[model samples]
Target: MLRRNLPSLFRFSSSASASKPVNEEKSRSVGRKAVSTALFCLTGGVALSALDDLAIYHGCSSKAMEKASKNQEVVHAIGEPVVKGPWYSASLAVAHKRKSVSCTFPISGPQGSGVLRLKAVRSGDDSWSTFFQSRDFQILILDAVLYVPGNEETQRNVKINIADNIPSPSSQACTRCPETRSPGKQ
Candidate 1:
């Protein structure tokens, strides 16, 4: 009787041990699948973020090009007022041999009363060459017109500003140089 019972006991212990390993293996497989899914999601999110940034950069680049192209044209030829900012607006109209720029600003406020400076450069040039500047002698009026001594034959890029003071661009330090130097120096 004892020998018969011993065989049955060994059979039961072996089956229990076998089933335990199978259960543990199933759990490990489930864990591995979860880790893989998480990794995939993280990688996809990063890729989408990079794509969004690239699209934004391209859009901004295109807009900047459009603005530059528009600026290259004579303001008066377009028959529309090009507003520089909330404080000022400008328009261009041809009269005889001169190009007249009509700039309007608010008649009230600290910024309202200032010397209006007009600057221009030849179209398609990065350098602010062909320098033409004039001060609006009449500070009491809401509208001021500046005359550029050129006809429609002369294409230019125009910029307008209203300020109590105008600082020289050369007065600032050159970004190309490591140290600040006099305007005369390279």
Candidate 2:
């Protein structure tokens, strides 16, 4: 009888080793799940960043364009073709004319703001030239569409008001309120 019971005990120990095989398979499955979860997180992070850039561009484009359009007379009167560089650049010597300057506000991404410089050339007898460099890295994509008032050699009697900087998700508006002024020029 003792021998019969001993064989049964050995059988129980053998069944325990059978579980080792299933344990190995479960470990592998867990590893696979972890890898896939990590991949999903990385892809989601990239997509979110792209969406942020698109939002910023769209929100700022229209407002900036409107402001620049209002200053079109100045651009037509004083702006000279910015030759020798990209079409985006325009040199303008806005003397006594309204001028709206758009600056690339840095998004504070890893690549900081790329190089941006605008120049201006005055028109007249022995006209001079100057570079708009006060806020070198503050201007982004700028378009100076000229809208000249009829029959004017140059527009010198309009008000030049640069639109306020559009704050980003990471930035805040002015701490103190700017002095209020009457809406468009009277």
The candidate maximizing TM-score is: 2
Clashing pairs in 1: 76-92
lDDT of each: 0.39, 0.40
Model 1 stretches with alpha carbons more than 4 Å out: 1-14, 68-186
Count clashing residue pairs per candidate: 1, 7
**lDDT per residue, candidate 1, 65-176, as tens digits?**
2332243122332223433323324222222222222232211111222112232211232233521232122221121232333467764333433222443243445667
TM-score of model number 2: 0.34
Q: Each candidate's TM vs. the true structure?
A: 0.31, 0.34
Question: Worst 10-residue stretch by lDDT in candidate 2?
Answer: 106-115
**Given candidate 1, what's the lDDT at residue 91?**
26
Name the weakest run of 10 consecutive residues (lDDT summed) in model 1.
106-115
lDDT of 2 by residue, 75-96 (tens): 3443432112222332222223
